[model samples]
Target chain A: MKSAKAKAHTNIALIKYWGKKDPKLFLPMNSSLSLTLDAFYTETEVILDGNLEMDQFILNDEIQGEAETTKISNFLNLFRQETGILTPAKVTSQNFVPTAAGLASSASAFAALGAAMNEVSGMKADPTTLSTFVRRGSGSATRSVFGGFVEWQMGTCNEDSHAIQIDDASWDIAMVTVAVNTGKKTISSRQGMQLTVDTSPFYASWVETAATDLVDIKQAIRNQDFQQLGEITESNGMKMHGTMLGARPPFTYMEPTTIDVLAAVRQLRQQGFEAYYTMDAGPNVKVLCHLSDSEKIQMKLKEAFPNNPVIISKVGGGIELLS
Target chain B: MKSAKAKAHTNIALIKYWGKKDPKLFLPMNSSLSLTLDAFYTETEVILDGNLEMDQFILNDEIQGEAETTKISNFLNLFRQETGILTPAKVTSQNFVPTAAGLASSASAFAALGAAMNEVSGMKADPTTLSTFVRRGSGSATRSVFGGFVEWQMGTCNEDSHAIQIDDASWDIAMVTVAVNTGKKTISSRQGMQLTVDTSPFYASWVETAATDLVDIKQAIRNQDFQQLGEITESNGMKMHGTMLGARPPFTYMEPTTIDVLAAVRQLRQQGFEAYYTMDAGPNVKVLCHLSDSEKIQMKLKEAFPNNPVIISKVGGGIELLS
Candidate 1:
């Protein structure tokens, strides 16, 4: 079978996706908006080979163990069922972003894998169909199928639930990522989300508030109101983390450095710069700002966190076939 | 001019009071529940001395500066207005707890001062009247007016809002205070609460959810259900902090060590102990547990943070005249 390689960039949720309504189908409890970024991405090559006894998976040139390989194999089974390809696949993937550190690595990873599979299987599916295929691998992956600002609609079922692009983000907006800890988090996002859903008393409220935030943010983007967009993004993220704290055996992904970065962002805004911050289920903080203020924000974050890594990323495109 | 001394113990809120509806009256946006602890207490003496030129204030044997002296003097003015005593008083106070480190030192401080003023001025106010009096000095102090478990109702006006005893806490409940940082927090609780109220988009939801948590926790206390009480207490504290995180230019009182202590508390609960943690606007954590499990939880926390001070405290009494 012909081999195909594809690339997909990571996306940071402005309106966060924290809980699941249907875990088996990977359906979110509320719609989420995200910005696909250019700085970090993943590339995966897939080829179906009848000679292979079983599926082989390599990540960043390193062979994955049973657990990682099994996850990929099961994910690929979805594609196999659709295209009627029974041959075991050899998959080699490389991630430029940090994994399991709230950087949305799985988003790019699965989106690329899905795109590569679509090509190798000769499916020629549209972006919407590709989003559904990618989402089965990771919920956030559905948004990575489109460029700029995308929203993943939390439809009642699998078929109706998919991502739609809100804006191309060709405006003056950009993001600066402060990597407090690029290493893997002790608790995975999946585990943390599940814990919050099962134990947090405020879980239902979080879903309701997130839905409201999604609507507000979409309107803000349509109106090109940066302030409203930033405000909703910051509030939505806090609500998500709040649910985690209220969860049974409460947990927090924020470290002291994370707070420091956020404080710096606030200070910048106080100093007449329009900047706001949002954090996911890890220690890193991502600041949403105008493209003009990106360098200034990056410098300020670097000065505050001299030891940590700080990177600036522009809005990125959707999944692409890399021949 | 009869001088009187009174003692009141510190109370840590399980359901937090973060915002103010009437800032001048010190009325909270939501009712809060707290447990008065035996470990930390404040002693204050008040005398309506006609010989004094102005109100004098001393804390822990140290003559307080203008700001602190003024605060005590202003609080004393309320007492003077009620009892028709225009004489400038001499106020001396001592705190056995760590001040401003999220140990609820102000709770005990104002409660003791209220009791002393009541005695010296001869107001003959009961506990409910005394609660309203203490609330003017500090909101949490309203709860400190009573021993055992107390709830500060978020009344519509100054007269109606006051704390009442929820339960005697005569059961197996106890608390272990982990002094993660004994130093004063840079952001005072008053300042922090105002910032959150003004800036956080989640502030309204926090108030609503806290009201629900208050009802649930009070019911749990009535049923003498340690598990339910502990669960609601932990969730309530997290929700309060989550609001702060959503604040514009978001702020968090949680340090790295604070998260460490919380993780330890969760581990303890997982190991069959019913330990739960609650925090205010400071980095320190107070763990609520059964009297039987208190020692074990303290030992475990001590093992985790060898440098920090861990003190166990049981149910304490209401304000009492010491002289």
Candidate 2:
């Protein structure tokens, strides 16, 4: 048996990746940018053995259900097709995230899996090849291939729709993750994105504006304009979620406590703390602000939500293959 | 003094009236449909006196400030120019709706004002004429001039962009309004609408889809297809609010309690109830259902929100000029 292990950080989109132009190939309708966070990540190990009858998935030291195993096998098939490896593999994952908080755990999970698979296969693929490969597992996983600030250009084809690092994010930037009380999310990101694309009236507009937002947010990063970056990030995320509200069955990820968290972030801004909020396809709200203010903001959020956990995170590194 | 009093029921747009093509003339970008409710209304008396120094504005039996007076005077000026009446009228209003709840008291207020002014000036105007006249004061008021299910056409110019009754809504339709707890809205509807029109990436799509929704809902009304009507009404209203979430400075009217009410409504749906909810530019949620089920739904909502108020309303009549 030949095995390899890798770890990848979770990335949160500043310019969100929403609908896909091609779902099978994972080609996005618009480009997106994301920031890899230090707080949460996933470690994945892939073992290749001729003795294995079928692919096995182990998650959090426990055997996963058939659904989870099947998804992993399908994702592994993408690598199998590319690397010409026919032997099934045992895949193990340790996800260090608030399990059902709507955080993008799939991002790190797939990124780590892709990296470990590449290592196990003795494949020295470049960033673009790795990004496109992992994207098949999850669209947002495209950005988790790189560290700091990364932008995934929505290329017209599968090969070109790859993520590239934009900035090292050495600035004093931070995010306070408010893991608000959330029930199991009914609408998965894949289902929500497809629904928005197929039925939302605002989908076309979302695609168009997201492209512009990618450019604007990049410039904000270049200028080290915290306020501009924060505003664009918040606005872009809101617009992404906004399209979901216009879907055929019209759904929103916001729960009651989510609104309360947002109001608290706005209150922080009013009190001279430059905190801005961004939400993904779940009820949890993340506040982006200066690293110096993160502890204070976390304290404030704690007061507002005594029972919830507020974690502050800084910039994280790119995927790493363990020796 | 020549005076006429009129009473108008507040109409809540199903295919919501959002944004404007011509703000000055109050020409909506997309046609909308609404259901007038009997529970809330406004009474206005327009007193035309040739000897009065200037227009005197009174609201809810109290004298209004200069800002309110100026707005009323401007609305009156349109009538003055068209009817050749130079008299400065005393406009007194009795508001029977929740103030600042975003229940669209302006719809009834403007409709009644338009009717009273027409009667006082001896103008035997048709519904189209009255709709166009009232629309200058408020856009949704165009539908308030008619009763039951009304459609306001988004005509190319001022004259054509008027409302007409599509159905008497005598098919046992009813609504249960949930007045969720809310703070004073940070952004007014007029300001929010303009922001959405000017900045929301989804604005154009909203206008286009809203037109389609209007057409489909009107046909549903004609066919008495309760399911189709309810779905379209709920989707359209959600789309309208969705645009605001994509605005430059994104905003949401959803409060914490508002989401709870929506959840409660969804729970009712899960329990095999044919109840759907819609919201305006306020934190309140109104559930639409059959008249036979309204009381039951209201009871359920009351149980969910024991401290809040839930009121049931039926189809309302058109604007009436009280002799």
Candidate 3:
């Protein structure tokens, strides 16, 4: 087959995916689903070049660091070994998230990368198949392959666990992301989850209960019930943090400003605005508001927190090839 | 009425009492209550002595600090005005639990003081009356006036809200308290609660939901269902901490050692032991195990944490005058 290139965009989980049952296999403790926003996504291009010494990866216009680079390289190496491609391959990527101040952008970035790579390799693969490759890259990234509303099926094995598109999210739901990156994080999510797995008393409880919430949240999204979705996501995120609090040393990912943003969101909700927020590993605030009311909500939040500029976007589509 | 002396005790809520509608009147936003355990308790003896110039307060064998002394003296001044009592009173309190250890010993201690003072003043008052007086001293202290399974009614006015006993633990449940006083607390519960009320989005959520849980937990206790009660208390405590974590600067009462103790408790539970822990504002672990199984739970915890000594006690009764 002739060499080809494919560009794919990333996605984000409004209902965050956390807590893995098996970290080695990236088996999630619960099934988490999300949406693919048009804004704040990754654009990845895969080139099948048989002349390279080794498979190459360039993230966001820069060469990946030793540790991170090795991870991506290993993923590519494994893929190459499976395909029996004796010659190496090369991959290039660029993340369009300006400084990307949190909100699990890497999930979408890598998932998009996997989708683009699979397509360029002449593979007629579905999201689940694409997810298998992304899972080797990052667990949450597996969910980014499908657009609209997507679900990460946390199966028992690598063959079964994958991402599937749930809905197109072509409705009036709006998302506003606020970037807040102060400096280096005290602890990474990897370390936090590991600590929770090793030390938290409620880890089992979390794993047991999260599936129910995730299922309910997916149904809520399908129903386009913003209130239900928001409430469940808020509770699910808090419960995940609850497990973190029970972890040894108990590191909290929430920042003082994040609390302020959440308070503002609740205040907006109380003021008859259908607004809710979900957070990931960063200090940024992403609000799920209605498109019709987005401007007003954004203006009020902007007035209150003029220092933090909010980026507004509607429901985004799934990963696709560059025309 | 002749001048006399009497002793009293107060109860402390594991779920905190926060956001007073009226701080001076000590009107809480919601009703809170707790069990007045036998092992860690407070004793207060009050003397109606005309010889004293004013009502003097002593805690843990030391004269009250300047700020605390002022706060108490002001409360007493108000009480005396309301009671129309001419003679000055003296209050002495001894806490079985250590100071600044996150245990709400002060709550029970102060409640007992109010009861004892009322008795010595020739005011033969019921628990309701005692709760009113104690509420003025500290919102949580009023709950300590009742023995087992007490609920503090968040009364709107001075007449309606007070602590009431739901049920006396004639049942078989026991609590093993692990007192870990690493050092003086960096944040007092009062300050922490204030921060939470002012900053946390979950604060309103907690305030709205606590009453329901409070009622449900009371029912759980009445049925003598250790599993239900343990689950409810742990969840309630977690909900309470949720607000704290969402607070600005996010003060955590959870120490590393506290996590260790919690893991030990859960490990024991997994081993088919009837043990679950509920934590208040401190780093200590209060394992709510069955009275029949206290020794085994304690031994298991001791095995996990050799440095800390666990005190196992059955459901303790309310305070009484030491004859």
Candidate 4:
């Protein structure tokens, strides 16, 4: 059996993609688009052999437990049944990027693993087919297959629903991530978004509005309209979060210091700086500003929050196959 | 001069009443409505004797500072000037309600003082005039003059912006307050609401959508539909807070325990309890359920959170003049 390994990095959604329509099928409750960043990525390798007693797993250089192995095995078992490999198999994964730091690492990891597994298995399937298998593993992972500004088209089923690239962010609109305290939330994004979808009256509004906002924002990015892009991104993110606030028990990723950072950003805007901020499932803020203004804004932010290190990177390249 | 005193409790809109076409005239950005609680009420006494030295204020049995006193004294001074009073007046305010606890205490305090001042000056103006005067002090307080469920008409000018009682709490809904750790917020409602109005994009959405919710909620209360009333109140309040979340600096009144209470309430609903919650400027959670289920829900809540004591009260009566 020939083994193949492929590594990919997942992107964080500036507008935020939340709520799965079907948890089983990984169909999203709303269509979401995100920018694939180059700074953080994930890598996974897949080996196909019939001699394995049972499916073995390794995540981040460590063997996986039953919980981590189920997603991979289930997808593999389904894929094997579709192909003719009825015998048992082994799957191993290694996530190279930051683990569980509120940035999406698993999505890329699973997407790469799915692609590699398909490659080694010689399944004669396309990226979308691999994406469907990947979606079952993790919903947002399906989007990691494409690069640039990708929109996870919420399909009715595995075949129709997958991610598509909207625009290459390589030209402008840098996503500046300010590194704050890194601690995983007690409630996972899956649990939180599910609770909100089940309980919040505001959830439907977010679902309805996100489609329009995503389309408008993509257009703004294409036009290089910084103000429109900034405004739309901020509003869409806030709408996604508003559902969480209205959830059965409201929860937020906002830390006390997060407000201070926000205040500094607003102060910068008041001082004639054209910077806008969008935050995801964490306390740290991501500012969407022009590439030219990034340095000045980063300097101002550093001065305001000396403790937190700010990293500035422009639109990243698409998923690259590493040797 | 006939030294008469009349007591009035102000109304605080959970939906928020901010912005004014005419600040001096007290016109609001939107029409707001609220319910008056018997547990919290304010009493004010005013004397229009011509021998006083400027406008003096006695708040909570203590003489207020010139600056602190000026908020109320200026309104009184304006009224006195209009009524052709030659001497400076003295206004005494006794807040017989919760203070600095995000309980709309300021609204009740100012409304009561405005009513008393009007009465002492022998101005037999109707509720409309009284509300306008009270609104000249604080926007929401204008709605408190009318008992039961009052609506502050966001008229273009002083002539139209006044509070009117929409419905008496002749229904089965109960307001249960759960006290969390009480401390003054870094931002006061006056400052916070102003910030939200100036900076929040969602502010317009709140202003546009909340009025319809308020009107529908009043009808739902009149129809004695607990479910509709609870749902509307919760949605309206959430929409109001949504604006604050989108405020440039993004401020929230939610604590972790506040979220816990909300979750517990939802859990109760899932457990076959008919309960929903609404929150205001404070971290406390106020559950709106049927009067019959109040004790059962409160007991369950107490069991769930031993530290937080839930205060359950039936539909409270309007303000009564205590001589």
Candidate 5:
């Protein structure tokens, strides 16, 4: 068996995916849009050989436990089954981004893994096909397989529910990520999504509105309307968090730093800077702005949160086979 | 001219009123439910005299500014119109609760003023009519006119939209108010409500779900189901905040200490204390639990927030006039 290595960058959702229509199949309830970023990425190497007795997984040079390895093994099994390769695989992965901190590290992780596994197994699947395969491991990873602007369509079936590139995102759009909390969250996105879906009274409305937002955002992207895009992105992200707030025994992911960053972003906008912010299921906030103003926005955010890591990223490319 | 004094206690909404269908009339877009608390209240004295040049308003032993005086003057004018009394009035009010910061001080303030105005004008309006009059000043004040559990019905017109007692709340229900922030909020309730109504995409859904929550909670109150009531109360409060989150240039009222109090409440529930928390438009959180557990919850909250004020209150009575 041949070994393959690949790298893929993380993507931040402009329109979030909050709930699963079919948890077992990993089908989302609403379509989502995202902007793939260059600042954070994951690289993975995979080797399939008959000599391997069991699958092995290593993350960031540390050996993973059975639970973590088992997840990776199951994901590889999808590619193995497709290519009729019964040999166990050894996978090594490294992340440049903060893992499990609402930064969409999984988007890069699974996207790279899928690309590497596909190459090792000689599947030679196209990007769209690879996205469908990677989505089984992480839903947002489907968008990471494409470059720049991507949209994941929440189709009725597994075969149809795949992501596609919407734009090259070669325009002036960029993001300033404020890493407020790099620590792992108490609740995972998977667990949080399930809780919101099962208990939130606003879940149905979230699904409906997210679809509308998806449509509006796509139009804004097509027109290169930065203001409209930023507005919808901010609104969509809040709607996703809103659903979580309405969940039973309601919880919020926002910390004081999250609010502070948001206030700073608002202040920046008031100062004539065209900046808007969006957050995932953690304390970190990502400020969307024009590429030309990214440095100034970063400076303002750094002044407000002097201790936190503030990084600026432009649009990134899709998964690539390194060697 | 004869002067009359009346007192009314503050009431915190379990199902919140987020927006108004008619801003001019102070009519809410959704029905809301609240619990009248014994710990916080306001007293006001009103006197209508033909010799008075204009309305004079004093609050907490200090002369109020023109804005506050004008608000009180306009509220008294409602009674003037009803009773055909052209004379201006002198209104003096004092609060037992923290004045803003989500303590629902406006509930008690306007309820007391309405009761006093009703008596001085010789309108002799019933509690329901007085509630409607008070609602024009503050929406939550409509519920404050009644003792125990009250529901403000979101009627189509001003004549029909009023508060009525849902339960006398003679049961063991009580609240431990954690005054996390007593200072005035940067965003007032009136301004926040307008922003949410005009900007939030989820505002309509908030109205719809709040109506349903009101129904479910009223039934829970009737059955005296503590767990159900607490669950609905917590969910409703979160839903209200959720709408605020989705507002354009989104904002949240939750502070770091507010989240700390919420976590403590959840911890108490996890430890089988049957405690649940609800917040208004500020950082303070009110833990709803059995009257038997109020002291214990208070102790735990005090331990968690050593510096903040923690007060326990049971079911309070309706507005009453003094001779």
Candidate 6:
């Protein structure tokens, strides 16, 4: 048995990926840019065993049900198809992230799984091949395979719709994650995005504006224009949620506390700090701000929400083979 | 002094008019539909006194400031332009609505003023003509000139963009006004609409979809389809706020309590009552439910926020001369 262990940090999108262009292949409707965070991540180990009748999937030290295990097995089958390696594999995964509340956990889960499977298969594939392969598991996992600022390009087909590292993000940027609610999400991002794509009247505009935002934010990052970068990020995220509100049976990820945190972040700017807020498809809010002000922002958020966790995170590294 | 006293009820838009295609002329970018509520209204007395030096504008009992007086004066000037009345009228207006929140006070205010001026000037203007006249003062006021479900047609020219009564609304539909925040609105609906038009990436789609929803809701009203009517109204209101969220330096009228009320409304539906919530440019929420269930929904909302005012209202009449 050849076993390999790998880990990948989670990434929070600045310009979000909300809908799928091709859900079957996990192709995004638009290009998305993200900042990989140091605090939250996932690690997975793959064991290639020829004796096993089927691939066994264990998450958090417990063997998963058939439905859950089959997802991993299907992903492993894709790996075998790509690498010409046909061996049953046992996969064990653990998340350092919080309770699922739509935190892009599948991103790091699939990225780590794909990396470990690649290692065990002895197919020393390049990072691009690895990212594209894992994208079939989850669209956002494409960006998690790379560190710092990453962009998942909305390619025309399966081959080019992969993520690339844009910047090292080793500068003055940081994020404060206000985990307002960590309950299992009522509407998964996959379901929400499909709903938005199928029914939201504003979705076509979202697809168009998100593409333009990606270009502008890339320029902002190149110039290190923090203000431009933050503004584009915040507005792009709002537009993503905006599309969901126009769906047939409209929905919102913004809970009351999510709005409270957003107001506090705006107040930080009023008090002369550079803090901007963005929300994915959940009640939680993530603030992108200066690394120097993270402690102050965290303290202010703590004052507002004494019970909830307010975490400060800096730029993180990409996926790696664990020692 | 020939004084005419007129009273008009404020209307809550179901298909909201959020932007201006011709802002200067107060031509809305999209047509809107609204339900005229009987509870909150305004009364205005316009005296065509040519002996007065200038138009004296008094709201409630207090004389208004120069800016406020100028706005009333300007609206009156347009009234004079249309009717050949050059009188510098003494205008006294009183609102029965709550504190100066964005509760569409201007709708009733302008409609009452227009009706009073029309009476004093002896223009003998029909309802359509009167609605067109008041639209210059406030766009939504065009709808306030009628009772029940009124549709403010988004005409290309000033002569045609007036409201027409679509449904008498004497049926099963009713509304519960949940006053989340009656304090003065930070961003006036006028300014917010312009901001959305100028910067919100979602505004264009809003324009297109709003037009579609207006048509669909009108049909729903004609058929007395409560479910379809409620769905369109809720989705339309959400789409309106969704545009504001995508605006540059985004803003929202939903406070924490506003969301609380909204959650309660949705919960009522889960408990098998036909209820739906809608919001405008302020933190207040208004729920449209079955007239039979208004009391139950209002009671639940009142329990959730005992300090807040929850008023139940039914279909109201158009502008009328008060004895």
Q: lDDT of each prediction vs. the true structure?
A: 0.88, 0.89, 0.70, 0.72, 0.89, 0.90
Which 10 consecutive residues of model 5 chain A have the lowest summed lDDT? A254-263
The segments of candidate 2 whose C-alpha lies over 4 angstroms from its true place after superposition are A83-87, B49-51, B181-183
Candidate 6 regions exceeding 4 Å error are none
Question: Model 3: which docking level applies?
Answer: incorrect
Summarize candidate 2's per-residue lDDT along A59-133 as a digit string, tens digits: 999999899999999988887887798888999899997665678988999999999998898776987789999
lDDT of 6 by residue, A263-289 (tens): 888888999888888988888999999
Model 2, total clashes: 0
Q: What share of the true interface contacts does candidate 6 keep?
A: 0.68
Candidate 1: clashing residue pairs, number: 0
CAPRI-style docking class of model 1 based on DockQ:
acceptable
- DockQ winner between 3 and 4, please give it: 4
The two-chain DockQ for each candidate, comma-separated, is 0.38, 0.81, 0.06, 0.17, 0.60, 0.75
TM-score of each: 0.87, 0.96, 0.60, 0.70, 0.94, 0.98
Clashing pairs in 3: A38-A316, A147-A318, B8-B112, B9-B112, B10-B108, B10-B144, B11-B144, B155-B161
Off by over 4 Å in 3: A1-4, A98-100, B3-109, B118-323
Residue A135 local lDDT, model 1: 90
* Model 1 residue B91 CA deviation in Å: 2.3
Position A168, candidate 1: lDDT: 100
Compute fnat per model: 0.33, 0.77, 0.01, 0.12, 0.58, 0.68
Whichever of 3 and 6 has more TM-score, that candidate is 6
Candidate 2's DockQ is 0.81
Worst 10 residues of 4 chain B by lDDT: B314-323
Put down candidate 5 lDDT per residue, B226-304, tens digits, no spaces: 9999999988898889888777767789887777778788889889999888989998998898999889888888888
lDDT (C-alpha) at residue B129 in model 6: 84
Query: How would you encode candidate 3's per-residue C-alpha lDDT over A82-131 as one tens digit per residue?
Result: 56554555667777765334556667667666766665655556667778
Second chain only: TM-score per model?
0.98, 0.97, 0.92, 0.91, 0.98, 0.98
What is model 1's interface RMSD? 3.0
- Let me know the DockQ for model 4: 0.17
